[model samples]
Target chain A: MCKNALTEEKFRELDSYVDTLPEKHGMLISVLHRAQGIFGYLPKEVQLHVARSLNLTAAKVYGVVSFYSYFTEEPRGDHIINVCTGTACFVRGAEGILKELENHLGIKSGQTTPDGRFTIDALRCVGACGLAPVIMVDGKVYGRVKTGEVTGIVKEYAEV
Target chain B: MSAYRMHLLVCGGTGCRASESKLLAENLQALVMTAGMGREVQVVITGCFGFCEKGPIVKVLPDNVFYVEVKPSDAEEIVSEHVLKGRPVDRLLYVEPEQKGKVSSHGEMPFYKKQLRIALRNCGFINPEDIEEYISVDGYQALGKVLTEMTPEALVTLMKKSGLRGRGGGGFPTGLKWEAAARNRADVKYIICNADEGDPGAFMDRSILEGDPHSVLESMAIAGYATGARFGYIYIRAEYPLAVHRLEIAIAQAQQMGLLGERIFGTGFSFDIAIKFGAGAFVCGEETALIHSIEGERGEPTNKPPFPAESGLWGKPTCVNNVETFANVPPIILKGAEWFASIGSEKSKGTKVFALAGKINNVGLVEVPMGIRLREIIFDIGGGIRDGKKFKSVQTGGPSGGCIPASALDTPMDYENLTCIGSMMGSGGMIVLDEDDCMVNVAKFYLEFTCDESCGKCTPCRVGNKRLHEALTRITEGKGTMADLDNLKELGAIIKDTALCGLGQTSPNPVLSTMKYFWDEYLAHVVDKKCPAGVCTALLSYYILPGKCIGCTACKRVCPASCISGEVKKVHEIDQARCIKCGACLKACKFGAISKK
Candidate 1:
């Protein structure tokens, strides 16, 4: 049932980490956190491995992975571009900024580039609405960004 | 800290940090040290000062001199003029929009004058990462007092006396919920602080956790002691990395100091708290959904007759309170219940911290007494709408909230009054919409959020909100029919009455409230097929003014759709059918010839 999602080394590491957890009952969330940290994103095979270790159903693990917006099954790009679509940011022109990014990168939201260098996604709020129309390229935050600036921001991470 | 004669507090909250306030802090500290005032003067990076409009704020202590829009370059002048020569920099001082003179002290400023800070008491004051700073401001004093003196019953009774309602949209009485959980005897009960503040513009919970993590930890431990529970969980959002870091540091610091984790204050109670990260879900803001999420399951709300207080977490009695509500607890226990309850209106007591953003001039956070007029918050604290524009509406309660129009600006903003006006206190996200904002578009925006966020658990929220968003989209695209309006009102009522959780029930608030107040705007969208605020692009058509047109080929060259055609230096004509409405032609026109109607 594990399906050999990971190498023997990776599997052993995950097993040892799970062993360190104080309680085993509700450790799926913590395990998921570690999996995401290690693999960047959770694939079906990886999720199956987690379920097998935790003695949980595959359906149960998949249900959780799909429920939260944070957990993604697809492989992420090298740099993830997060555009804040919070009400505050939206009103202050996040839509146009997103459109600008889409135009510059030749990709829509939730889609990665062919080169797998960048992926653009719109978030509900990063709790930084005070700086509306905010964008986070990787973990670096850019705020008060004008529509004209989107191309420059995208160009910085463009393929050489 | 005591050796320093004066301290320069630079705001290091998310808002300020975005504007390079951390760099400013470093420059100030380095500049201060360069001047040989190393031990005498200290530079501290504090949390949000709340007035983010003129953010990257630097406040000098003792003198109470406040500076706005402070830059890293200004560090040289500030250190030389203020520290060495003992003179406040006049150019760097915060200039009141109304008054001509400098507003030095933060207290005298119009923005903070009408406000009362209880939950946000230490937000702009203390260094959030430093436990010592939180301690200096009397942080964990309440936890000590509660553990030493008050019993579970007595603390619950005191909370009941304080009349503090849940700040997390529900507005449920905090004390009553605690009493319910305390009454239900269990071998192991649970206390969960709902830091899952999913509301878009609302960052008050995040601010409290980032600014004063101890208050929430202390409050949770107090809840554990009061509710006869030994374990607690703080379900915070992972989006707030700064708050999460501070919380982890604070939790570890508390454990080391014997504030948390076994035998608190040398008492018999052994209450400990752990951090549980919420993977982005708006519905999880609901208590039942939150409980399910913590259980490592899909976050969806179930029918609640046997509420979380009766049976929660692992089928044991549990108490869940909002972050702001928990933040208020430590203060309530520190000061008497009467003192906490004395402020605000008759029904609602104490203060509410709002993440005031959007068209407001002062776009940050503000804590004001309940029952305070909307006019006061909008005009006084918020510094009125941005660019001196006419106030359109203020949306409260996130997606679950309705808009309060400019006509009702004078209305009191307590829970009951807000509900009466088809709005709620919501997690205190008072996003001010200006005349530039289209009400139809605004309603559509909120509906779109709820529709995407609705956990498909119930038919009403899942299908109903989706249909509502579809209808709004049709209207915005200038294809709405008269029947759509009727369908909206009817469906909104159904969703409100039948939805399983609090989130689903209030999902239609934006639709209902917008239609109620801005009826004419909706009618305009349906009948005239025109978005009054020029927000809807489908309703807009680009036309060239013959009189102003200089036959510039710029319009034709830039037009991606190849719809614009005319000779060079002549009037360009755009084919209505062929036009993509991308606005490239309009932007290309330098003579102001192209205009969209």
Candidate 2:
């Protein structure tokens, strides 16, 4: 498929970057970060390529990938919605906002919509406690969000 | 140096940036240029002003007028009136909530009155991306002093005398950590700056990294010199894009200025630093786990005795320190240990930066001296509870910490005192909870966090925490008996005793402390099968009051389960058997007929 060729080019680019590193012993995490950036998510092939490039076992690569909450093996949607559920956010009624979003999207947290338009996830804290009950669509932060505003927020992203 | 007539300092912190402070800065700049006061006036986007409650804040120098909640449109008035005509904007000033008067200067504000600024000294003042701005404030002087004037042993001794404890909740003496690393002779020693601030409600570390990154960098270089390490790594969180970008710029600027990388000031000491990104793991805040994470391993903690100082980071002696702890280093080297020691209580020296959030009136960052009373932090500095709500408890130290009840408001906040009262001065996340928040739900919330974050390396942490979370869940769901309460206590104690790492050891603190203080609430949940705070939806039942019901059919139309029955203009009744307790009807009713209990 045409998509496979495009992905191969990305793989070559990742390989070139891995080759440029002076030391490869402790560069797996950094390489995986780059791989995820390029591919959007780390699939089996990408993880295998990273494992081969870093001289790490595929199991080792998978172990590191699965250990961190930041790394994901599955493909993500175009827009990722992260609702802050930290203590500050929780106390400030973030649960109501999250529930509203879950109902609006008809998908639970960590699951993408059927159309693959948005993926909702819960963040422990983005260190933006000053703006309690915060959410980030893609990377743009929306702070002090109310349950009534959840549908309007999703509509902006959905239209885009 | 061009001496500008006046300077406008804008808050460029994450909170303010979220509120479009950057656009406000650009607007101010454009206006300044248009007024031809570009040379006469300077608009600098500095780090967090600490008063994030009323951001985006813009402060005017020379006059020292502090303005809060500034919009991009307000930039025109600020430049036209404040900057051009030398007249301060009256409406934009921070008003004292209690006094009902506008406070002109930051010094006069109650939010900053009781606060001390040591770690956050250069945060709001200096331009973090510029090396010259950092140098202007005696920035690398400590590194220079340590490198040229003092020997390695003397630097270590001076640090030991400073009595600066680790601010990352361990409260370990910084000097002793350095001494251990210095004592262990290795060819390739390392200095790691732990910027993996994982506490949910805390952002002080990110603020420091974003606002005054050079402080942490300068301290790390000094730490390297003291420990005789040539290479260092700052393991920071990847989630903080602004902090990561600022640190990259700061490192490049520092390297170009000969402050970092290779021989500094033409000394034989050669040092360089690199950044390692953490991929969202809370356990990586632990030093040993952090070391493993840097080595590209699954960030799991190994046992102590072979500590990071003894054997770490490829089995070499490594000195790992927290961002806040390292930020305190440069000042201690510049000002002697006694001067720093005199500021706080005897054991806990210097100040602690706490991220005051949740139901507090003024939710922001405040660095107060140790031994300050909790009431001072909550009432005086924080402006008391938001919406005039009754303060129930304040959760400190994040998930690893416990809630302090209102009775302990007068208790002094130090390492020992906090530990004595079933809490630790964790990474300083002070989330104030009001009477509306349920204590049982709060305990469950922390337990859920710990259970999800547990690395599964130890049995007590992985299995025991899951069980504790289930017990807490049972209590919250009104399905718990008194025996479940006993099981929670017993399992919590066992987990504390048998857990391998600090993450597991202190995980049950929230549950235990809440049980100790709010046992009556828990009893009400288990015995009466009722949630006193009305937070547990499973324990709540909705009823329509006949006195207030207008029969508008609003509740009937909005009910997802179609459980509400009655015609229009007639009193509606919710079918008790079919009611899902979604509270949709309660929210939709216009007459305020619905009540939950």
Candidate 3:
């Protein structure tokens, strides 16, 4: 398993954090956030860690994490890129930009580059409709981005 | 002694960030460092501050100086004047809409005056990545209470008294769902948090998970305790990378503290959580479909005779709740159940988190009491329509719900109230529609989304939604008869009645609601062969007004269709026959000559 993946010791570490938690319910989110910060993903051992920490059964943690669209277990790349494909962005040429990024990165949406330098993702809307064709790189947004500029923009991040 | 005792909190939500809040932070940090007062002056990048119209917001600690719309260039002046010299940044202060030049803090802002935020309590107060900050704010108190003081039965009773219901489309009593799972005699029960918020223009779940993942995790643990569940799962779409990352960190923190594993709080109970990734299938938002997807099957909803509570993951009794629903659990537990029941209307017991997006003055996440009127959310909280445009309709519940017209703005925003008015508060996505929005095209837009997101598990949802979309498309193109309208109503009702899952059942809501409220728009499309809002390409004609035409040849030069032929400073005539109604000339026109009718 990768270092980002979970381990028995990591599970213990997460479990210890849960024990220190004053409350039970709201801690799952924070615990998961911390786990990801440490392990970079919510793997099985990490999930086990979360379950033990929150005083929840593993299946319960699994069920809650699985039910939501905001929890993941897969290891992500170093840098993440999300291109908005909202109504406003769609009306603009967002699809062309996304396609160009996908081709340049040699990976589809939800996949990281083979070198683990970048992960490309498509989002619904980043609320920058006034500046359509918006792309967010690691929480920093670049608005009015063109398809032709995608490769150069991504390369800057990759080289970084 | 620490040189500077005061801290500065800046709004760093997507909205504020878009308005150069990060740049502002950088400038302030740089200025503070240069002034050699960096150690004492702490800057915290917090979540949504709610008064989005006045963002990027900056709040000074101790004095509580709330500054609104602070630009990057203004940051150095704020630091130099406020941080170093003890003078406030007067110019960037928030000016109230009603009282011009009167500045106020977030507490004094009218947008937050009438609002009560439980789900959004920790959002703007804490750094989302830090568990300690959340802990200081009493983050996991409910989980501790549940584990130490309350039994499964007692917890269920408290929930029942609270009248807490699912915030994820279905307003089913949360206590009852827990009770169902509690009553089920199973060795391995499960709790599921439904974070797969697939509704169009919806981000309530995403924001909660991002802003406060700990709350959801802690609540699910409480649910596990109440329902006698041995495990939990959070089924989130692969899209929300930030939320996912935060959740992962929270889980690790929980585990490290020994709150999750065997013998938590010296108790014998043991529970664990895992995350399952979604491929952006909208239908998976449904409980049964979600359960099926988690079980390594296709994400399609099965019949409810054996509901997930009866037979869920691995054919076990499972209690499933949405992200918003789970978020409410901790508060209900910490604060008495009756305390939760006190707020909102009688039927709905608590606040609802809505993504107040599209043509609204305040386009961000908002949490309001259930009984609050749509008028309050749209006009007051949302600061009314953008650009002084008249409000036409507001689409709630994504593509599955109906368009609520301005006449129904006073309607209470509870589950039953919204449903009674031909709209359901499905996932709390309220897309504000302006006068420029064509109702016919709006229905078509939602229909198209439904058709695409449909899981194709049932014939009614798969085929019926597509046909409805086709009819709406036909009407938009001015090629439909009144018969098409009748057919839509008939087909819509059938899909609702016969569809196996909620996706199909509510898919026809937009078409039905628009037909009821904006029937004139539909009639204009069919009878007059015109798009009243000029949204439908086939029904629209781009023409340059004779008097207003500058005849600068700008329209002709920019027209991709070559549809305009005119002389300079003379009457410009658009060749309507040749015009594709692309509106290129309309956008390029300098003298406001072009018109689409």
| Best DockQ among the predictions, by candidate number | 2
Please provide, for model 3 over A39-122, each residue's C-alpha lDDT reduced to its tens digit, 9 standing for 90 to 100. Answer: 777768777766765667888767655644345666788888988866445544576799889988889988888788887877
The candidate that wins on lDDT is 2
Candidate 2: true interface contacts recovered: 0.74
lDDT of 3: 0.80
Docking class of 2: high
Could you tell me which residue pairs clash in candidate 2?
Answer: none
Tens-digit lDDT string for candidate 1 (B230-335): 9999998888899999899999998999989878888898988899999999999999989988998888887888899999998899999999999898889888
lDDT of 3 by residue, B1-597 (tens): 135597888776656777788788888878888878788887777766755556788889878788877888988788888888988877787766555756546667656766788988877777777787778888778888888898899999999999998999989999999999899999888999998877756777877787788888888888999999978999887666667888898888887777676767778777778787665678889999888767644577889878778888878999999998888888888889879999999899899988776777666678899889999988887778878889999889887899999899999889999999898989988888888788887888778777777877689998999999999989988899999999999999999999998888998999999999999999999999998876788999887788788668998898888877868777778787888876678777777877888
Query: Which docking class does model 3 fall in?
Result: incorrect
lDDT (Cα, tens digit) per residue for candidate 1, span A2-101: 2223567776778889888878797787799888877778888889999998999999999899988999897777889999999899999999999999
| Deviation from native of the Cα of residue B134 in model 1, angstroms | 2.3
What's the DockQ for every one of the candidates? Answer: 0.71, 0.81, 0.09
**TM-score, per-candidate, Cα-based:** 0.97, 0.98, 0.82
Native contacts retained, all candidates in order: 0.66, 0.74, 0.06
